[model samples]
Target: MATALQAVEVIRDLRHSFNIGRLQMCRADEWLNALLAERIDSGEKRSLRSSGGRKKLQKH
Candidate 1:
């Protein structure tokens, strides 16, 4: 499993790649979810957006 910091780095890199058109949106989403799964649960996804949560380890 990747550490939360590593997951954040992976997410940032994937977003950068997508912005550069090197990665399609679908592929970027897949990669992000895959990396995030190492730390985040599916149920926490909504809270991340809804609550404006920045830290991955924060409560949902």
Candidate 2:
């Protein structure tokens, strides 16, 4: 069995690999779904501001 410290190190490495910088814009919905399902590492909860002409992703 792996030690606790070793497991933590592996998790940290995996989290680094899952950072948003690694994905393409075309996969945003897939990423969002995975994030909602707790399958991805969302570093923080930040709001995305929609431009004046663009429709927002959420329904009010």
Per-model C-alpha RMSD: 7.9, 15.0
lDDT per residue as tens, model 1, 22-47:
45656766765775564356565554
Q: For model 2, which pairs clash?
A: none
Model 1 residue 56 distance off true place after TM-score fit, in angstroms: 12
Spell out the clash pairs found in candidate 1.
Answer: none
**Candidate 1 accuracy as TM-score:** 0.32
Q: Which runs of model 2 end up more than 4 angstroms from their true locations?
A: 20-60
lDDT of each: 0.57, 0.40
The alpha-carbon deviation from the true structure for residue 45 of candidate 1, after best TM-score superposition, in angstroms, is: 21
Clashes of 2: 0
Q: Which residue runs of candidate 1 sit more than 4 Å off their true CA positions?
A: 20-60
lDDT of 2 at 24: 55
Scored against the true structure, residue 48 in model 2 reaches a CA lDDT of 24
